[model samples]
Target: MSTSLGRGLACSALAIAAASTAPAEVPRVATDIAPVHGLAARVMDGLGTPDLVVTPGASPHEYAMRPSEARALQEADAVFWIGAELEPWLEESIGALATDARVVELLDVEGITTLEFREGATFEGHDHEHGDDAGHDHDHDAGDHPGHEDEAEGDHAHAEDDHADGDHGSDHAEGAAHVESQGDGAHADHAVDEDHDHAGHSHEGIDPHAWLDPGNAGIWLDVIAEELSALDPENAQTYRDNAAAGREEIAAAVADVEETLSAAGGVGFVVFHDAYHYFENRFGISAAGAISLSDASDPSPARIEEVQETIRDLGVACIYSEPQFSQSLVATVSDGTEARAAVIDPLGFELETGPGFYPALIRSIGESIAGCASS
Candidate 1:
């Protein structure tokens, strides 16, 4: 070979080696549940995948983290969770395993709307379409709490100001932002005072299932993208674009759901629990009753009777059960009754974890409720 050609070949080899090291390391993200994992995954699309701590079919209220889950946290560069109100079981694990990770308490994320848990055995006169003048009473300021969905009747707390503008990098700790209520909403003890139990931890506050509201999902996608971008700035544009695209997808999903439920204003239904309140509120529908409380404890005989009565009096078309919980309760309530029974998987237990999963989850919920209403 000629001397010049040999020198050029050596230079090309050195350039190739330098180019390989130019890309930044992808972040290791961890999430508390599948829904949140789906959101994080969207933000990190084409970058890396986030670890889901509590897999589908595993109750976040009572999950025993596997060794693999713990290891994921230990290796995580960042963590996303809805706060103790939803998954108190993961608190200690995160504290111990993901100490260095930037923890995002989504419940504390500002500008996100929230609602107080309804009180009572049955929603009865609390129908969203015909809701009486009865409103809500909340303690501990929720930064951006809106009044009764679109109306100005109810006064619930919403956490804002402290969590917006990409400011969710700090570790979530005590007094982060807790909600206390007198349970004086239109509906039982939905919002007990400052002390409640979820996996034997303090959980007196918001519904924690904010993901049900496609509006909140949009808010969360931006926050997820911001948090991921902060860690992986090299792909910041990709993260931002992914977040925007995710929001657009959610927007389309919301519009489709809104159209499906447009005429469903007064359609009454019973849920397995109160987890769907966010979804109900988003689409302007309300549950006639929930067979069990938000805690998923066995309902008292009186509560069951109340729910059954609600089903009968309102001519509730369908009773929805969740895949993660017992179907017997829904069956028991609707037995010998005309109400058709159905299932709505809140965590998208049947979904593949990815960018498309979040919108699909919301769409499934809308379809279930709308389908039941028409049935």
Candidate 2:
């Protein structure tokens, strides 16, 4: 070949090699909760870290989007959240703020099993939909405690303002009615009204804490991998491989948790809120009840008495508090009883934030329950 022709061939060959080895473009991701972020982070391992909107120790129910977080959502290539029910505050804002971002509501995703909110369970009676009721009074000073910065201290004041004028009440009632209609027709009307009277409450419907279940997390791992791979097909195999490996790690962690809990035996306990039904149901452990129905509202004196009575009646082993909220209520209830008070960070607030956080969070919960129950 002539010199110019050979030079052209050499340049083309070099270009082809460079193109083949080039790294895939990583997408900017935003997750609503820490646990979900942890799952997505695992799928995005070796790619990029997903930004977390709700910071550590913050309750999703009452979390306000900071300007930085709002920008993160707006700039994200994809935004992942549990659903409108879990973070009703984010329902309207996400549309406006992250208009161009692909919003993935994980609860709506397939292959994942969901648990319903149990009646009379911990934090079961309070309505999350009606905003904060002035009559319901439970002291929330625990949020101001050191190291618990993001607890829902002033959430009630802004709860009503969080949504558009027409977004909450009627829509919530309609959704609740839909849920009731799905049930047997006999109690549909009563159940619908009772359940959806408050737009944000989820007392009689699907529990949003699905990530508490390791099996559910495993399912989510696949979904996250699929979504990420779709966004960046060049690294599709890497995403799938990471998900597979993450699934194994989660499975092993879950197995270890199960064994530990088994050795500790079943311990009937009480949680600060009703967030752990998924975890409890998944592990076959039972919670006697919750301190409040929603973290933003305090349990009434009557409600506290009722829960204390349950603890006494059931001989519950432990009363578990969350890191995001004050343990005062747990302390008060356990004062006259033999039940031990313990802490469990459902959102992985106490653990390092990342892909490993989910498994660590799950393991910590099991360990806490086992410790309190066994002791």
The candidate that wins on lDDT is 1
lDDT of 1 by residue, 1-375 (tens): 999999999999999999997889988888887788888878787777778776566667765554455666767889988888777656776876688888888777655666666777676565442122213222323322211122221111111111111222323322221211222121111322223454454324456777777766676777777777778788989987877777777778888888888755557788887788778777777788887776436777788888888788888888889876667778789886789988887888777667678888888888888887776
For each candidate in the order shown, give its overall lDDT on alpha carbons: 0.68, 0.67
Model 1 ranges off by over 4 Å: 1-21, 125-198, 201-204, 263-265
Least well predicted 10-residue stretch by lDDT in candidate 2: 155-164
lDDT value for candidate 1?
A: 0.68
Taking the tens digit of each residue's C-alpha lDDT, what string does model 2 give over 1-375?
999999999999999999999987898788888888887888788777888777667667645554446656667778888887787767776776667777778676544556657676443343332112212122323321112222211100000001112222222222221122222221111112222323465565777877776766776666667677777889988877777777777877778788999999877788887788777766767778888776656676777888998888888888889876777878888878889888987777778776677778878889988888778
Range of the 10 consecutive residues with the lowest summed lDDT in candidate 1: 155-164
Query: What RMSD does each model have against the real structure?
Result: 9.8, 14.5
> Model 1 clash tally?
7
* Top candidate (TM-score): 1
